[model samples]
Target: MSRSILDEAHIHPAVRSIVANNHANVIAEVKAAIASNPIVVVGMAQNPFPRKARRVLDDIKATYVYLEYGSYLSGWRPRTALKMWTGWPTFPMIFVNGILIGGANDLQRLIASGELSGLVAA
Candidate 1:
C-alpha cells in the first residue's frame, strides 16, 4: 500500500490507535468533501483562527466545510493526535481543492492577493 504523510512511522502509537477508532473516517470524509466542494477546513471551536477563517470564507461566499473538533469532543484530545498527524501546529487547517492551504493568516494573504477567490471559484 502507498504511504501518506500520516504514515505509522511518523505518528505515535497512541495517536495511531486513537485515530484508528475515533477519527478513522476523518481523512476520507475530508477528501470526499473537498472533491465536491473546493474548500475544507478542519479546526477547533475554542481557537479563534477557525472562527475567523469561517467568517472570512463567509464574507467571500466561499463554498467550504468546516470541521470543528477540539472543544466539542470530550476531553478534547483527539485534535492533538490529529495535529500530529497533519503536522500542522494550529487550528483552522484549511484545504483548498484537497491541498493544505495553511491557516487563517495564509487565507488572508491569499484573499488579499485575490487568489482565494480564484481558488474557490475554480
Candidate 2:
C-alpha cells in the first residue's frame, strides 16, 4: 500500500497545515518511527489496547516502538488523522514492518495462530 496518500506531509497544504498545527510534532514523530522501526504501535494514553499490545510484544521479546497519543489533548488530531489514513477504527494501531496488524486482539489471534511469531522471527 502506498503511504504517501496517508501521510500528512504529502496531503494538501491546507490539510497538512491543520494537522501540523493541531498535532505539532506527532505526524513527524510517527513518520520517523515508522520509517526507522521495524515494529511500531500507535495508541493513546486512555486506550488499554495499546498497553495490552505492548505487553504482548514484550512477552514475545519483540523489538518495537510505541507512539502514545493523547486522549484529551492536542495530540488527538494526529491520532484522528492516522486512524482515517489507516482506515482502522480502534486504538493501538499496530504495525509490523510498516504494515498494519490491527490491534491487541488481532495480535493475540496472530500469536495463537503462530503467524506473529514467524513475522517477528523474520
Candidate 3:
C-alpha cells in the first residue's frame, strides 16, 4: 500500500539545526542508546501502509520492528510490549529508548521542535 497523506517524514529545519549544532553529542547518544538497548525503536504495523514511517525510521538509523497482530502471534506482541499507547489503534508506533514517541505526526512534530535530538541525547 501507499504511504498516508499525513505522513510527515521529511526532516524539519529544527532537526537539521539540532543535528548540526550537536552532531557529535547526538551521534554519541544514539550510539549509546542502541548499544545499551539493541531494540531502541520498535515500529508497530497497525496499518497496511507503512512506507513513510519506515522511511523515517530508516533515515534516523533506528531499528524497525514490524508487529502485525494479524500476521503472526508471537510470545511478545508489540502492543503487549507497548501497553501505554492504548489510545492509538494503528501501527507504525514508534518507541525510542523504551519510551512511546507516538506515531508519524508526533515524530514529525518532535523533529520540527528539535526535541527528537534532545531525547536521543538524553
TM-score (all chains, Cα) for each model: 0.72, 0.74, 0.45
- Clash pairs, candidate 3, are 44-92, 46-91
What order do you get sorting by lDDT, best first?
Answer: 2, 1, 3
Please, what are the lDDT tens digits per residue for candidate 2 over residues 1-122? 64434555567886766655655466677778988888899888877789999998899888999888778555666787777667788888888777788999998999889998677666
**lDDT score, residue 73, model 2?**
57
Residue 47 of model 3 has an lDDT of 46
Q: Which ten residues in a row have the lowest lDDT in candidate 2?
A: 1-10
Off by over 4 Å in 2: 1-25, 72-74
Question: What is candidate 2's CA lDDT for residue 59?
Answer: 93
Residues 57-105 of candidate 1 have per-residue lDDT tens digits of: 8998877888777575552666765665567788888988767889999
> For residues 18-53, could you state the per-residue lDDT of candidate 3 as single tens digits?
434433443344345545652344343344335566
| Local accuracy by lDDT, each model | 0.77, 0.80, 0.52
Error of 2 at 31 (Å): 2.5
